[model samples]
Structures are given as C-alpha cells and as structure tokens.
Target chain A: MIIIISFFSFILEYLFNYLLKKTLFLPLITLTTTVIVRPFFKKNNNLFYMFCFILGFLYDLIYTGNFFLSAGIYLIIGIIINLISTNMPNNIFTSIFKIICAVIIYRTLCFLFFYINGITIFSISNLFKSIYSSLLLNIIYGTLIYLILYLLSKKFNIKRID
Target chain B: MHKKEKNKRTIIILSSIILSIIIATIFIKKNFNIPSYGIKDGMMYVNNIITRIFGNKDYYKLEKENEKLKEELEQYKDYKSLNEELNNEILKLKETLSIEELISDREYAFGTVINRNFDYWQEKLIINIGKNKEIENNMAVISNGNLIGITDDVSINSSSVILLSNHKFPLNISVKIKIDDNYIYGILNNYNETTGTYEIIGVVDNIDIPQGSKVYTSGLSSTFPSGILIGNVEDVTTDNFDLSKVINVKSETNFDDISYVTVVKKGNK
Candidate 1:
C-alpha cells in the first residue's frame, strides 16, 4: 500500500510539474497527498520516512538535478508533519492545515536557497506573488486530496493505525 | 518506555540521513561532471511518450505551419544568394580599386524545444539538439526570425538556452536604431521584473528616439550575429542624472508559444 501510494504521488507530481512548468505557482501534490494519506498507516513510521526520502531524492534527480536538495526538504517536512500529527486530531481540517503549513515552510526554504544561490534577484513584490500563488494552488490541491482520502477510508472500512 | 525508545531511534536515523544528504549535495556541487546515470534521459523519454499520447494537439498543427514557413524560407534563401552574388561582384570591382572585402559566413541549425526549467522567473530552455549537432555554448537561438536567447550548457544530446528575459543571467547586447541617415546606439542590459521589459541604457541624451522605433543587434559582440531583429522601442525616458536615456524594449519573440528555434553559428563561408 505504501509503495503504491508513493508511486501514485510521483506520477501526480510529474504531471503537475510538466503541465505547470512555466507558471509561478507550483503545486506540491506528491507531498500533500502523502501527508493526507499518512494517517492510514500511522504505525509504520519508518516506512513513511523512507518513502518520503526516496520520493524526494527521485524528484531531485529526475527534475531539478539538484542532487539531495528535495530529499532534505521532504525529510524536514515529514518530521514536522509527524511531530504535529502526534498532538493534532486526525480530521480533514487538520490535514488541510498541516499541508498548508508544510507548503509554506517548503516554499520559504526554496526561496532562501535560490536567493543564496543568486538564481533569483530579491524583489519584494515577486516574492509575495510567488508565495501567494503557491499557497493558493497547494491549498486547493491539498484539500481535494484530503477529501478524497477521507471518502476512500470511510468507504473501504480502513482503520486508522493509531 | 518502548514508544520513547522508538522515537529516540527515529530521531537518530533522521538526523543521520539529513547530514549525509547535505554532505552529498556539497560534494556533487564541487564535482560538476557526475553523470545522472540515465535518470534524466529516461525521464525525458517517458515524458516525450506521454506528451505525444495525451498532450495538446496544437503542436501537430504548428508543425505543419512550420513546414509551410520552411518552404517560403527556401524561396527567400534563393533570392538572398542571388543578391549576395551581385554584392560580391560589386565588392570585387571595388577591390580592384583598392577596397577591402567585408563579407562573413553564418551557419544555422534547427532544433525543437524539449524542456524548460520549472523556475518561473528563470528563462532557461532545453532543446533536443546538442553537442553531437555541433551546438556549443554562446550560440544564439532564434525563433520567428527574432533573437530568443543563447546556448548556455550543452550535453551530448541536449543543450540549455538562457533566454533574454532571465533576470539572474541577463545578457548585454549592443542595439541600434536608425533615424534617417544617423544610427543611435544603446546597450540592452537587465530585464526588469516589475515592468516586464528589457531596460536599454547608455544612450546619448542628444538622440531623441521616437516611440515604436525598431531595435536590432549591432553585432559588436561575438555572442550574437549582427542585424537580428530583437524588438521595438516601446518607451524612452531620461535617467536620474540626466546623462543618458532609459529605453524600454518590447521583445519580438512571443515566448509563450515557442515550439521550434534555429541556432545561429558564425563560420567561414
């Protein structure tokens, strides 16, 4: 199940990246989908972390060519989500909120990385535009994924591991 | 007690992985030639198949249009060769009277865009042709008879083009505007993100360039061939110190719909 979900997430990510290559807004569909479905396998923490690392590493290798950059970013996100999940109630709203937070944090780190690498010149308006558009698309995609997973779990009688 | 131990172990593992990733990133950054192990090639192959299967049909339509345009271009090439022969005859006549020959040769190769960088602000494109096709760094890429960008990185089967609109690696091209018998010179520098236009600087304050004046490459630099159509002057304003005027140019190439481009190379005839 974990492997299937990870592969599906990768396909979704690749499709989105190809479709929206030139757009300012990038949807973190794979990360969001993984986060939304994570509650289903809450007992398999090690498997989940490994899955995140592999997904991120493959993403960097195939798309960005930045080596382990996305791997590190995905691991950081996985850690944060895991930490938060321990305290937060498992619900659709919480899933959406967590995904939003993750997206924001990841984008901030990316911005800082690009700034340090001198790839993007610092412009306040451009930064704000990037943040807003990225947040908007990610939130929409995250919400949809959460709703779909919630419906699937209810329909299939899947029990939460916790 | 068992849960606490598991959590501690997880933290240790996560930290080690992160540390290793950071070290690997640094190492890869220093070693520039590390092969991608066929990952990039495989991904491109799959992507090409997917695009062919489920992608937009407009690309096919555009390919047909391009074929028609190529035919027209062949007709123009014949006319150009005849005109060049006449000019060479005139130059030969003048050479007998002690004038120097000034004609140079240029070669062009066509390529299709295979990929583009996902960074919105960075205008970089990857084309299908590469080092095997004699493509090299600094070759100018043109689309729709206008300058698009120059080649930056070239691999065995692909090359990355840095576009003119890129802010990080903005290109400087010498440009000119002909007014009656006089030619006005200026340097096109950085792309302004706010205004979405290329900033033209260093024009003499005396030359009053009218709005909608055509701008072309002055060919002062070896990076790009001379007289390639760049864009038209949209607006001109004086700088803060009043020494030179700041001109904004609207680029001729429509970046959104670029499908095919010709890489221009300068060589001996």
Candidate 2:
C-alpha cells in the first residue's frame, strides 16, 4: 500500500512537472508525508524512513540531478513529521494543520539547503513565492489522501498509533 | 521487544553512515548524480505524446498569427537576393585575406523540447535529442532563427540546454556588433530581467556605436558559430570604471514560448 502511494505520487510529479507552468508546484513531499507517516505505517518506522530515502533518491537522480541532497532532506523531514504526528489528534482538522506545518518545514529546509549551497541567489521574494504558490493544491491533496486512508484504516485492521 | 529495539538502532546507525558517505562523495566529486538516461527519455517521450493530444491552445488565434508571420516572411524574401550577394562578397574577401572561414555551413539536428522543470525552468531545458543524435556539450541551440542557448549535458537519449536568460549560471559568449560594416567585439555575460535586455561588456573600442545595431556571434570562441543573430542594441553606456563600453541588447526571440530547437553540430571546432 505504501509503495502504491509512493509510485502514484512519483508519476503525478513527473506529469505535473512537465505539463504545468512554473507557478503551480505539485507537492510530492507533502503528499508522501501525509500518508507514510500516518497510522498505517506507524509501527514500521524503519520501513517508513527507507521509503522516504528511496523516493528522495529517485527524485534527485531523475529531476534535481543532485544526488543524496533530496534523499537527506526527505529523510529528515519524514522523521520530524513522524515525531510530531504521533502526538497530534488523528482527525480532519488536525490533518490539515499537519499538512500546513509539513509544507512550511519542507520549504524552509529546501531554502536553507539551496541557499547554503549557493544554488539560488538570495531573494526573499522568490522564496515566499515558491511557498505560497504550492499551498492551495498541496493542502487539498494532503487532505484527500488523509480521508481515503482514514476510510481504509476503518475497514481493515491497520493499527492507529494515535 | 528488546530484539526489536536493537534492530531499530542498528538500522538507524547504518542509514546514517550510508547517507553521510554518499553525501561526502557527492560534495567531493562534481557530476556525481547517477543518470537514469533510459527511464527519463522514455518518460519524456510519453509526455510529448500526451501533451500533443491534449494541448490546450486557441487554434483560431494561432491561425491568425500564422497568417501575420507569412506576410512578414514575404518581406524578408525580398532581401534574400541582396543578402546572398553580400555573403558571396564576404567569402571572396575572406579568401583573398587568407582568413579562416566562418561555420555558416554545418549540420543541424532538430529536436522537440520535452521538459522544463519549474525549479530550473529559467536555467535549463531538456530536449529529445542527445548522444543518440551526436549532440555534444557546448553545441549552440537556436529557436525562432535566433541563438537561444547551448547544450550543457548530454545523456544517451536527451540533452540539457543552458539558456542565456539564466542568471543562476555564468554564461559568457563572445559576440560582435555590426556598425556600418565595422564589427565591435564584446563578451555577453549579464541578462537584465527587469528590462528584458542583455548586457554586453568588455568592449574596449573607443568609437560611437549607434543603438539598434545588430549583434551576432563573433566565432572567435569555439562554442558558437559565427553570424548567428543574437539581438539588437537597445542602449549603450560606459562602465562605472570608465574603461570599456557596455551595450544593452533586446532580442526578438520569445524565451517563454520555445517548444522546438535545432542544435548546430560543427566539425572540429
């Protein structure tokens, strides 16, 4: 189930990256975090981190061309999300809040990495634009994935850590 | 439970070590990213077909635009004979002076642009042709009959082009500005985003170069062929240090609407 979600997100990322204009960024990180760090994969921390690392490694290999950069970023973000989501309430509103927080952390980490590496020029305006432009679609995507998993978890015997 | 805890700790330590080693290697060695050449090319090919089938464009507007371009092309046709005569005269002069001939005669590989990742949209573009098409690094790419960029990285089935408008990368192409049969050479290195102009610096000539003069590749550099049109001078000014002239050039080629490009393959540059 986790692999299916990861693969779906990967395909969507490729399609959206090619088809969509520069303004609309499909949040692959946000979508992956919302599902993999949820109750379905809670007890399997090692597997969760492995999935994040591999997904990020593939992303770097194909898209970014900076090996291990996104892998490390995704691993750290996954760990942070897991630690936080364990304490938060497992409901619709809290899910939305978690998505928002995840996006903020993700963007902040990316900005810091890019800035430190001198990959991008120092521009606060550009950073803010990247963050805001991705918010609307990512929030919707995160929430929808959460709702689907919530329904599936009820039907099956997936342990809910929260 | 004790065994599970130990296993988890082992996994954490191993992961940390592996990640650190890979990161260190990447930092030490440039161009370390593993190339997924086949997979990327296949995905791009699929993307091209999908976009073609579901491309959203106003056809009526495009038809009208095409008609307008056809009329403009007719005007250029009138100057074709005069242009040919001048080119012939230039060739004769070069032969008489024992000068090296420009690479006006070359093979061109046509390719469709397949991807422009938003993160590097301004910096680079991925094209369908690569090593398979004999494309090499530093080859010049043109679209809309104007020099747009140069090929940077070539994979098995695709290539990445570094656009001139990218500020993230340092792009310095030697160019010549024609002023009444005299050419002023300079280095084009800066692109002004707000003004939509290119800045050509390092021109040490102490002469008056009028605005609207045409810019072309000097061919002094090995990367680009001579006589490829760059743009027209929009403004001319002296540098702050008052050592050399800086010319601002405006290009007619629209960077935002590029879909097809041709890579010029020169022989033994």
Candidate 3:
C-alpha cells in the first residue's frame, strides 16, 4: 500500500480530479516530501502554501497560455486544501471532496479565462463531451487516489507529513 | 473549541482561492487570448516512422490493388498500339486542355488502403506509403481509373490521406453521366458514422440511372486525375419542394475490403 501511494503521488502525471480540471500539485508535493524530505523537519509551515504557487503556475502555463496564472491559483488552492484538511475528519470522504473541489476550481478558472475573451467555453458544441469525460474520470481516479493514500498511511507507518 | 474555528478559517481560505482564480482568469482573457498549448510537436513524424518501420497492415491491401493494376497494365500492354491510337483520338478531342504540359505527364504511385477509422463525426483511413516511399500532401490518391481523395498531411515516412468522402473535404464535385453525357453537379460528403456511403445533397434532376452506375472524378480541378473511379452510384431520387436530387453513393474502395491501393505520385514528386 505504501509503495503504491508513493509511486502514484510522484510518477503518474496527468491525474484528473474534476470534470475538466487536472491538478498535480497534491501528488507531487505530498510524494516528494513524504518520500524524500520527511526527516528534514518534523513540522514545516512553508510546505502548505508552496503547492498553490506551483499549481497556479503550471495551470497558467498550459491553459491561459501565460505564466503565474496557475501558480497563484494553485498557491491559494494549496493553502485552502491544507487548512480544510487540517480541521476536517481526514477520512476517505474528505479526500474525495478535496479532489473534487481542486478540479472544479481549476476547470472553472480555465473556463473563466476563455469566457473573458468573449469566447464561450461552454458554448462550444463539444463542451458536454469535455464535461462528461471529466465527471466519469474523476469518480474512478478519485477513488483510486483515496485507496492509495489510505494504504500509504498504513504501510510505511507514515502519517500526514504536513 | 479551537478546531471549529480552524475549520471555518479553512473554508474561508478555500473560497478566497476560488474567487481569485476566477478574477485572474478574467484579467488574463482581457490581455491575451485563452492560454492553451497545442499538440506536441514531432509526434506526427514519429507516428509515421513507427507505422512505416512496423510494416503497415494496409500494405496487404495495396498489394492487392497492385496485383489488379498489374493485370490491367498487362492487358493494356498487349494492346499497346490500340491504346496509343485510342489515346490519340481522345487527346485530339480535347486539345485545348486545362492541364499544363508537365502536370499532364505526371504518373500515379501505387498504395493500398490499410486501415479505416469511422465515427459519427469523422471518418478516416490510412495508407501504407509514407515519406520513405516518396508520398506527400495533396497528391491525388487513385486506383486504376477513379479519384479517391487528396493526402491529409504528410510525415517523413508516411502521409495521412483524406478520402473525398470525408466531411473534412467540402467542395463542389462535377460528375458527368456516362449515358447521354448529361452533366450533374452536387455536394458530395461522407457522414461521420457511415462507411461506404457518401451523399450528394444537390442533385438537380430526378436521377433515373439504374443501380450500379460507375462514378468518376471530374478532373475539373488539378486535385484529381480525369476519369478516376470514385464509386458506384445508387439511390438516385429527387425531392419535392427542393430543386436538387439526393444521391446515395456506395464507394468502390470499401475500407473493409481494401487490401491494396495505389498512391499515384503525380510527376514522381
């Protein structure tokens, strides 16, 4: 369980969370620190906010065709995900919601960017195809992510590092 | 007691992040067009190379076409003198032709239909020839004496050819009837999910041509050679309240049965 978690969190790129939003920050950050930098500090504050910058920057690069748009969004998402996760039950359900929101926020933002340019993101005939794909994809992948994280928590005796 | 407060704070942070992403998206749109990257470069070239090195299955189909062509060529060779005389007669009838001297002298490269991709939105096929075999874009694809379609795009080793039946190629087709030499033009297109069926939406008169009328490409344009076989015409009917005839075309080169084809390399280019 632990090995699979570490592998998925780090290696498998292009993990989707919502109908159209694909985010990689949670996996990359969680895996890198959990597998590589866990001993450096028993507790660290900077890790929580950093994911947002990375996520926003990456999204901006791919979606908005600019820099830092995704960085800022991700930075904010990271902070939010971290903060909610800290106070929540931290169960399978919590993780699922986390993923759903992460993807929804990302997709909505991507749509907004296109919407502002007077081009309709949802207006295109193919919008439903994209939306349908996202919905079906999120349920399957989100469940897999939940299981991997659950297994990791048990196997390596790894707690939530953050 | 303190944990509840933290949960509230977390919710607030999440909302703020979403709000900011929304605002930022609008700002970016006002500045630049939607920021999205295109497909990866070099993938097409690599796919072509891979298809070639692996030996395209469509090669079998093209080989079959080649065998048929060879028989036709052999038969023509036997009657070479008659062919020359017949060709001369046809040539004199249309002396002031649209073809330039060099293009008129182009030769057809042989290939085969290797694979077929069909859906409700797009229908496509693959051929065995590629850059390794000297194939290029917009070169007319043909059989013994019929038009198919032009190449979609070319790779170093293989080129993707779009059939005339594809929805992607929308242009006027000028078909001259074999009998009575009656000329009829129509909009010929392939629906997304149908194989071996293309429609002519604008037939002008009731086409009483019986089943199995041979269809040919009218080489009104440089895209196709004159008199290349397109398909067999079926379901010719005229509609009320509409000025044109509806045509159901059953193509001769069904992707299902195609094992060989010729990529007629016009002028060896």
Q: What interface RMSD does each of the candidate structures achieve?
A: 3.4, 3.7, 11.4
Mind giving the per-residue lDDT tens digits that candidate 1 earns over B230-257? 7888898889998899999887677766
Candidate 3 Cα deviation (angstroms), residue A156: 18
List per-model TM-scores for chain B. 0.76, 0.79, 0.59
Which residues of candidate 1, in runs, are more than 4 Å off? A21-25, A135-162, B1-34, B59-104, B112-120, B238-241, B254-260
Clashing pairs in 1: none
Instruction: For candidate 3, give the lDDT of residue A117.
Output: 47
In the range A81-128, model 3's lDDT, one tens digit per residue, is 665665665565666566666655545554555455433323443333
Candidate 1 lDDT score at position B220:
75
Question: Which regions of candidate 3 are displaced past 4 Å?
Answer: A1-162, B1-106, B111-122, B126-136, B143-147, B180-187, B190-195, B205-207, B240-242, B256-260, B265-269
Please state the error at residue A73 of candidate 1 in Å. 1.4
TM-score of each: 0.77, 0.84, 0.44
Best by TM-score: 2
**Candidate with the larger DockQ of 2 and 3:** 2
Give candidate 2's error at residue A94 in angstroms: 2.8
Best by DockQ: 2
For candidate 1 chain A, the 10 contiguous residues with the lowest summed lDDT are: A16-25
Q: List-wise, what DockQ does each model earn?
A: 0.31, 0.36, 0.11
Q: Give lDDT tens digits, candidate 1, residues A84-119.
A: 898888776788788877777767766666666556
